[model samples]
Target chain A: MREVPVGEITKVVRDLFIDANINLGEDVLVAFHKALEAEESPTGREILDELLENAKIAKEEGMAICQDTGLAVVFIELGQDVHLVGGDLTEAINEGVRQGYQEGYLRKSACHPFTRKNTGDNTPAIVHLEIVPGDKIKVIAAPKGGGSENMSRVTMLTPAVGMEGAKDFVLQRVRESGANPCPPIIVGVGIGGTFEQAALIAKKALLRPIGSTNPDPELAAMEEDLLRRINNLGIGPMGYGGRITALAVHVNMIPCHIASLPVAVNIQCHAQRHKEKII
Target chain B: MAEAKRIKTPLTDDVVGELHIGDRLLITGVIYTGRDAAHKRLIELIDEGEELPFDIKGQIIYYVGPTPAKPGKPIGSAGPTTSGRMDTYSPKLIERGLKGMIGKGMRSQQVKDAMRKYKAIYLGATGGAAALLAKSIKKAEVIAYEDLGPEAIRRLEVEDFPVTVINDIYGGDLYEEGAAKYRRQ
Candidate 1:
């Protein structure tokens, strides 16, 4: 087995978290430009301009893109052939978050649910670890803000509803979300998984580049149809009203119990902050 | 949507009366900032019949919890958080003579009803455009709840801060109107 020092994991997490907050991903920027060209409403077009300018200033000044830098969400694919050494993996990850939030000057938004007390240093990152076949570890850090996250939802559907039911739920959520999630949002839907699995898969779908086609032809078509329908809702940028409400809709599907049809909708704002590294 | 009107802080009835939904405006002068945590504290003070940190009359409160300003900048990425979360507290504050609020998203009907009765208006700043919005804030100073970190209340001196009216005393709701205008299906 190849032994990998856990310190390296900490370092990777720290850098990825910081990088994700400061830099808006290239895919999101391209979507903004594309939306700007296609957007029809005057207010929608101007809001897109402001979003693009915000991205530029955040990059040039080395500042966190938004005040709500968000909770540090780490996804790790641990290889079966590798043995982690030197420290506890969970502790290493949390240390990285504490360091990143402090050094990056990003907001530490994690807090006690009832007391509403700040955790001080964004600690105890939501870490999702998966055992995989490779000898190398791959990690992704995505900072998810509260506004968009608050609007995401998960539900179990009867098999009778099928795709039509799924589509309706997705559309309703976006319509109700309106400006709350910060419009020009990305809608990630996970279908056919268990309760928690559906939510996880839906969130992972957001890690995919905006507007990229799904590998499965069936899923790809649904993604396109959903994207078109969501944008047609005309929530527009900042919900000021326009032709471009959503940047894209991405769907991920998996088989489940014959009786169950679980659906999850994960909404992502235009900031679209994420970074990945394999080591 | 004529040329953006110029608004100074500590708003009065004349200015509030003239502003309409969808009207763009550039606000200059001092405005105070607070979000959910600080707002809860302010409301508790009101419940106990204690004095607030700042006077409420004619003042505009911005719903934002900005990041710490790096050196050489007055504030870091200042942008509006979702306004719905403050619905519970806004009515009480609005009744106390608060004239305007800057935020993004739809407000509760209760908040709107209060706005209509209290002669206040809701404004929308481009959400997620924090880095750009920080440019308008010339200065920032935390005035209360320093322990709340980003959620602390701060006083900001700003110039030409851009926003659009979302709710007005005449009962205009921009979010509803804006969406209906664009909904094709």
Candidate 2:
């Protein structure tokens, strides 16, 4: 069995958090540039230009791309042949989140939901783990902000509503969201799963690079269609209005009960911060 | 279309009235910062007949909770948070003569109505452009609710802070009007 030290996971997670916050991925940056070209509104084009500049400034100065450093969401794919030694895996991840947010000068956004008490450090990060076939561990760090997370929605539609219903639901969500989730957003659609699974996959879809299509031909077509319909809503950049409300729409699907068609729309703002490390 | 306007803080009804939906603004001067927790307390103080920590008359409130500053920096990335969350408290604050709000997103109908009635305005700053926005903020100091951390009330001095007038005193709304103008179908 391949042995991996748990402390190393902590260090990696910490660095990933800091890195993801300060750097805008090239894919997201390219999407912004493309949107800038397609956007019809002069004000919307200006907003897109400013966003590109903002990304550059954040990277150059080692500052956060956005004030909301976000709730740390870590996805781990642990190889079955690997043995993790030294400490509990989950705590190591949280420790990394603690160090990253504290030392990186990132905001500690985790708080008591009801009482609104600050957790001091952004700890107890949301961790999702899966046992994979290989010997290497893959860690994905995604900092999810409250505004976009707040705009996400899930609804279980009747089987009769079918694929058209699913499309309409996502479109409605984006239209209703308007500028709230920060327009020029990315849409992640999870379809054909159980309720909870659908929501989880919808969020996971956000991690995919913009412009990447689904593996399945049919799903890929649906993604393209949804992307078109969403932009047609004219929510535009920061909702100033234009032809580029959504940068991309990604859909992931798994088998579900024949009687149900559960779907979730996880909205992500244009910042779309995520990074992955394999070890 | 009118040219983008340059304005200063302690915004007055006359200046706010001259603005319209879709007008770009370069706002300079002092603006107060608050978010969800701070807004709750501000309204609570108003309801309890306690004096607000900051003046409301002719002042602008920026709905933001900034990241912690690094050493040698006045503040960290500071961008506007979603404004809808403040809908319940904003009208109450507007009733007290709060002249303007800088945030991102669409406001509730009640807020639009209040803005019209009170002659206040709502400006939309670029969401997620925190780093760029921070450059405009020359100084930031926590004025109240220090325990709230990032949600603490801060008085910030800004120069050429960019924003678009989303809701103006004359019942104009950029979100609605702009969407209708550009929406296909």
Candidate 3:
């Protein structure tokens, strides 16, 4: 059995949180440049320029790209043969998040839902774990901001609505969201499976880099078609109206029960902060 | 929507009236910061007829919940949050003489009507441009709701803070106007 120390996990999670919050990924930067070339609105182009400049400043200063800093979301894939030693796995993850937010000077945004009380430490990360075949663990950290998360939607469709209905629904969510999710946004679509599973995969779809295509030809075509249609909406950058409204539309689908046709749309801002570590 | 006009805060009816949708701006002077939590608390104070922590007359309240400052910096990444979140409380604040708002995103119809009626304006600062925005805020101090953490109200001194006029006193909206001009369908 491969043994992994919890302290090792803790240190990795802490560093990942800080790094992801500060650096705008290279794929997103390239997408911004491409969007800048395609965008028609002068203001939209200007906004894109400012976004690029902000990314540079954040990196140089070692500051967060956005003030929200976000709620910590960790996706973990653990090997069946691996043995976790030295501490509880979940607590170690939260401890790392606590130290990261405190030392990095990032904002502690998690709060009690009803009472609206601050969690203070930014602890209790939203952790998703999958047991895989190998012995190593792969952890992906994504800090999701409230604005884009607030715009995400999930609805079960009638079997009659079909794929076309799902596409239209995704478009509608983007249209309704407009500038709220911070346009030139990344759209993560989760299709099929049970209702909850659809939502989970929809978020996971965001972890894929901007230009990658789905292995399924049909789904790949859908992603391309959606990207074109969304940008055609003229929502522009930051909703001021332009040719490039969405940076990318990523769709992930699975076979659902015959009775179910569930879909979830998770919108991500241009910041697109996520990092992965494998051990 | 011609050239941008340089404007200082604590705006007046005369200056607010002259601004139009799509006009760019460089706002200078002092502004107050308030977001969801602080807005709720401020509205509560208004309903109770208790005094606000700061004077509301002719003041601009930026909708931001900044990250905590690192050493040697006055404020951390201090960009605008979604202004639509402030919609419910904004009109009431406008009614009480809040002159301008600096944030990103759309506003509710009620908030727009209040801006027109009250001779106020809404300015759009580029969203996600937090680090650059921080460079404009020369100073920041928590002025109220200290326990609210990032949501605490802050009084900020700003210099040449860049923004675009999205909603002007004359019922003009840049989001609608700018988008309509370039929309193909």
Candidate 4:
């Protein structure tokens, strides 16, 4: 059995958080460049250009790409064969979040839900842990901002609503959201799971690289179809008139009870910020 | 297509009114920052017939809760937060002479209507570009609600702060208009 020191994990988490905030991921940057080129609307193209310029300024100046540094959401894939050594694992993660937000000058967004008071330090990360095969520990840091998160939705439909209903529901959510979630957004659809699981899967789907295809052929096709329909709604970049309202539509599916077809739509804005590390 | 123009911030009603939905604006001037908590207190003071920490007339209020500034910097990543949350308090401030709002996300119909009636405009700064946005803010000082921490009201001096005109005084909505134009038929 391998023993992993808690401090090591904390250090890694802290570094990853700082790095993710300062640098726009290459995949997201490349996707934005592609959007700029393929965007048919002059306004859309211009919006894309502004976004690119913002990114350049962010990188060059070592500034955050956008002001909403986001809530620290840590997804940990722990190996059954490995045991955490020395101090508490959860506390270590939270401490790391505090240090990272402080040192990096990232915003502390977490607050008491009812009081609406800022926590000062972006602490007590929303951690999702999974025990998987092998001895490798994988950590994915996804700093979720409030704008897109507030727009996320979940519904459990009767099996009879089927795929058509699912499609309509997803499109309707996006259309109703309009430019609020930040146009040219990425739609993450989670289908065929329990109520909460569906929501979680939908959010996890966003972690996928933009413009990448799902391995399943059927899921990939649905992604394409939904992407086409959402953009047709005419919510161009920043909701200014444009052909590229949505950058991509990603779907993740799981088996569900025969009586229910649960669905959740998680919207992610142009600043789809996430980073992962395997230790 | 119209050419993009660079305009100074602390934007006036005249300049804001001239902007359309899709116009890209490089803003400069004196802008203030406040979010939900600060807005509530400001409105409460106004309701109680008390003097505000700062005058609302002709001033642009950015809906933001900035990250704590690092040493030697005036402010941290100070980007816009969601605008919808400020829907309730905004119209009241507009009536008090508030001319502009900088934030992300959509405004309620009531807020949009208020913008039209008051000749104000809602500009959208990139939501997550906090660090980049900080570069534009040359100076910041907490003017009110210091107890609210990051949600405190701050008086700011900005230079070429970037924003897009999401809602205009002429009942024009960039979100609706832009989406309609490029939406696949």
Please tell me the TM-score of chain A for candidate 2.
0.99
RMSD of model 3, in Å?
A: 1.1
The clash tally of candidate 2 reads 0
Ranking by TM-score: 2, 1, 3, 4
**Lowest lDDT 10-mer window, candidate 1 chain B?**
B1-10
lDDT at residue A120 of model 1 (Cα atoms): 88
Candidate with top lDDT is 2
lDDT of 4 by residue, A1-279 (tens): 888998988998898888777787888888888888878887677668767877887778776777777899899999998889999989989988989998887888888889877787888899999999888799888887788878889999988988989999999999888767776788999998799999989989999998688999999999999988887887778766677778889999999998899999999988888888998
* Residues A56-169 of candidate 3: C-alpha lDDT, one tens digit per residue: 999999999999889999999999999999999999999989998988889999999999998889978999999999999998989999989999999999989999999999
lDDT digits (tens) for residues B47-117 of candidate 3: 99999999999999999999999999999998899999899999999999999999988999999999999
Better of 1 and 2 by lDDT: 2
Interface residue Cα RMSD of candidate 1 after superposition = 1.1
Please give, as one word, the docking class of candidate 1: high
Give the TM-score of each candidate: 0.98, 0.99, 0.98, 0.95
DockQ of each: 0.82, 0.82, 0.72, 0.66
Model 2: share of true interface contacts reproduced? 0.84
Query: By TM-score, how accurate is candidate 1?
Result: 0.98
Of the true interface contacts, each candidate retains a share of 0.83, 0.84, 0.72, 0.73
Q: Residues B89-183, candidate 4: write the lDDT tens digits.
A: 99999988899999877889999999999999988886665666788889999988888888889999988887878889999887777665666
